[model samples]
Target: MAVVLEVDSVDDPRIDDFRDLKAADRRPDRPGGKGLVIAEGTVVVRRMLDSPFRPHALLGVDKRWQDLAPELAAVEVPFYRASAEVMAEVVGFHLNRGVLAVAHRPPERDFDEVVADATTVAVLEGVNDHENLGSMFRNAAGLGVDAILFGDRCADPLYRRSVRVSMGHALRVPFARVPDWPGGLGLLRRRGFQVVALTPDPMAPTLATALTGDRVALLLGAEGPGLTEEAMTAADVGARIPMSAGTDSLNVATAAAMAFYERVRAS
Candidate 1:
């Protein structure tokens, strides 16, 4: 059973964890730039509470507290109740989600641990956009990607925006960072994973033919740049989505979704 403390003033220091959400440097969630895993809205918050990332505190209006009563009964945490106006003042914006849960970032999972027992995985490179990273997690979860492996220079999937965009899927899907860039791809290959690089090259083999392996690892890159030459070289084969001629390349997340769908279809 959680404690519901009614807060009439936004200046209450007890709710500091929910303060100045938009302030890049000062936001409690963004402590030292690596923000806490923040779950906004009832759905995402419920997912977070159900996930391994445990919430330390929550802030929202009375109605949201009532709405989350069933879920709240299972956790022993503090719920800071505030009006929409006070919440907007404290968080630095009008958050229509009406509720927020803040959790400390959990330890990163080991690459081998993340991929062990997985048949399908999504490997990412240079994907710095938060929204794209979130969407990728959502797609991976939806289309049966077992885990997400990060290569180099990827965005923080635990960021608030990413969590919201992912509809809490990021919290549910397991992800890990590969120690080395292209060099680390050998780990997957050694594990019998057919590392397939996704590219825009029309000459490359179609996903249907390229993804034939007992275990498949789909490598995706940023939208404009796609995969690097080194990354492509590291893969066992290059795969394309078979788009119409003259059309631009798909967004990285969208491209990954198509490949994920193809993987499911073929299985």
Candidate 2:
């Protein structure tokens, strides 16, 4: 069982881990980070406890702590109680989430293990926006996609902004970075996953027609550049989402949502 701590001063040394929340992500001495995985709100903090990331300590307002009593019932960590002003002082801003949990990031899963059971997966290349990555995971979780694969040049999924943007879904989704660039795509084909490259090219077949396979893996690229020719040709087929003419292509995450929608619709 965890102890409830009464903290009156913002300078309390016991709550040091919760201090300097902005610089906490930097790894000045540790291997992966000094930046422990910090969950800002009640939802994300709950997710951190449920995910591979385990919280060492919690800092929050009293009401927030009371609200989290059930989730923290068996947790052996200290809940550092503070006022809204102190939390704002420590976190460098007023956190509307009212609660924060800090956890160490777990190891990354291997590529083979990540793809083993996925029937529908989204593969990303150079899709480096943290928000996009977060939205993609949320869409995948809600829309029934099995997994996500980072092809290359993707953003850090565990980044603070990404985690918050994902609404805690990033922690639930399983992902692994692909080893080789375009060549690693062959690995999916070998696993019986029909790899389809999503493109904006009107010449390509519609996504509804292109995504016909027992196991489907959709390849996506960054918004402006789209998929590289090398990445596109590497896949078995190129699929296009039918959109109204003259307007720009959908945002990468939105496009991924549409594809995930198609998968759910098919099932």
Candidate 3:
């Protein structure tokens, strides 16, 4: 069972992992950045506990701790109990979520392992926005998409903001980086997945008509840029979501959700 430790002082060294999160949780390449996967709030923290990330410590208020007590019974980490005010001071912000958990980043899942049993997956390119990535993972989880594969220039989906925005789906959903950019997509193709690129072009077929494979991989790109021409060319087919006359495109995450729904509807 997890140990409950009272933390009255904001300067307690044991809770350092939860301190000054803005700077400490930055990308691993940045100075003072640990690249730890931090889960905020009760829901996300719960997800992290159930995920492979394996949190080493948790910091939250007494009420939040009580709420998570059942789930933490099997966990072996220290649960640092503190007042909301001290938590705010430690995290360097007023966190309304009232709970936090920190885990060291695990090894990235292998691409083959991520896709081996997936009948449907989402592939991303240049989708660097953290919120969009989070929403994409949430949508994927809700709509039965199997896994997520990262292409070129994608943001870390496990970034703190992404995990929070995902409502912890980022922790539940399995994902892996696709090697070699557009060329790597060939692996999916060779594995019998029909790669469909989501585009805004009017000439492309609708997502409903283009997705016909027993195994499918939907490709998405950044909001303004959409998929690179090279990525579009690599796909087995280009598909679009029907839209109103004035709108040229949808937000990447919204578009992804629509496509994911289409896959679910077809199944």
Candidate 4:
């Protein structure tokens, strides 16, 4: 059972963890840097309550607290109630969701473990945009990609923005970072994954034709520069989504969704 304690002061010590979220993010904390996995809004907060990232405390307005009551029952933490104004003063912004919950980051699973039974996985390179990273996870979860692998220069999927963008799917999806650059990709190959580089090159075969393995790893790069020539060369094959002749390539996350959908459309 959880007690809902009202907090009127902007400087309440119990709610200190939610203060100055931006500054706290860079305060030399290990893991996700803020020493916490923050969940904003009613939806994400509920997801956090249901996720492996268990909340220790929550700060929200009266209405939001009422909305969260059912989910909070199983949680052992206190819900620090506050006015929207005071919460704004503490976090340095007017949070529309009027609720927040945070949890310590759990231990990271090794890449090998994440992919042990994966039939379809996404490998990202230089996809630094947090929203894109988040959307990719949402798409992966909805379309049933087994897991996501971060190759190099990717954003923190646990960042507040990423989590919100993922609509809490980021909390459910499994991901792990790979070591080394193109060389790290060899590990997937040795595990019998067919490494297929996703590209915009019209010369490449369509995804429908090029993907021909039971275990497939789609290698993706950031939106603009696409996959590097080095990475393209390292793959077992190159694949392209069928596109309109003059239209631009899809956003990286949207492209990933399309690819993930293709893998599961029949099933």
State every prediction's TM-score relative to the real structure.
Answer: 0.97, 0.93, 0.96, 0.95
Better candidate number, 2 or 4, judged by TM-score: 4
Give a tens-digit lDDT track for model 3, residues 19-118.
7876544443222477688899999999999898899999999999999999999999999999999999988889999999999887789999999999
In order, the Cα lDDT scores of the candidates are 0.91, 0.85, 0.90, 0.86
Error of 1 at 199 (Å): 0.5
Which ranking of candidates, highest lDDT first? Answer: 1, 3, 4, 2
| Residue-wise C-alpha lDDT for candidate 2, range 83-193, written one tens digit per residue | 999988877778888998877777789999989989999999998998999999889999988888988789888777778888888888998988899899999999999
Pitting candidate 2 against candidate 4, the one with the higher lDDT is 4
- Deviation (Å) of 136 in candidate 1: 0.6
Ten-residue stretch with the least lDDT total in model 3: 23-32
RMSD of each: 1.2, 2.2, 1.8, 1.8
Could you give candidate 4's per-residue lDDT for residues 1-267 as a string of tens digits? 779898988878888778887565452122545556788899988887777788888889999988988888887998998888999998888899999887777887799999999999999999999899989988998899999998878898887888889888778888998878878889999999999999988999999988888999999999998887777887999999999998989999999988898788889
Off by over 4 Å in 4: 23-32
For model 2, what is the error of residue 187's alpha carbon versus the real structure, in angstroms, after optimal superposition?
Answer: 0.8
Give the clashing pairs for model 1: none
Which residue window of length 10 is worst by lDDT in model 4?
25-34
- Model 2 weakest 10-residue run by lDDT: 23-32
* Pairs of residues clashing in candidate 2: 24-35, 25-35
Q: How does residue 35 of candidate 2 score in lDDT? A: 48
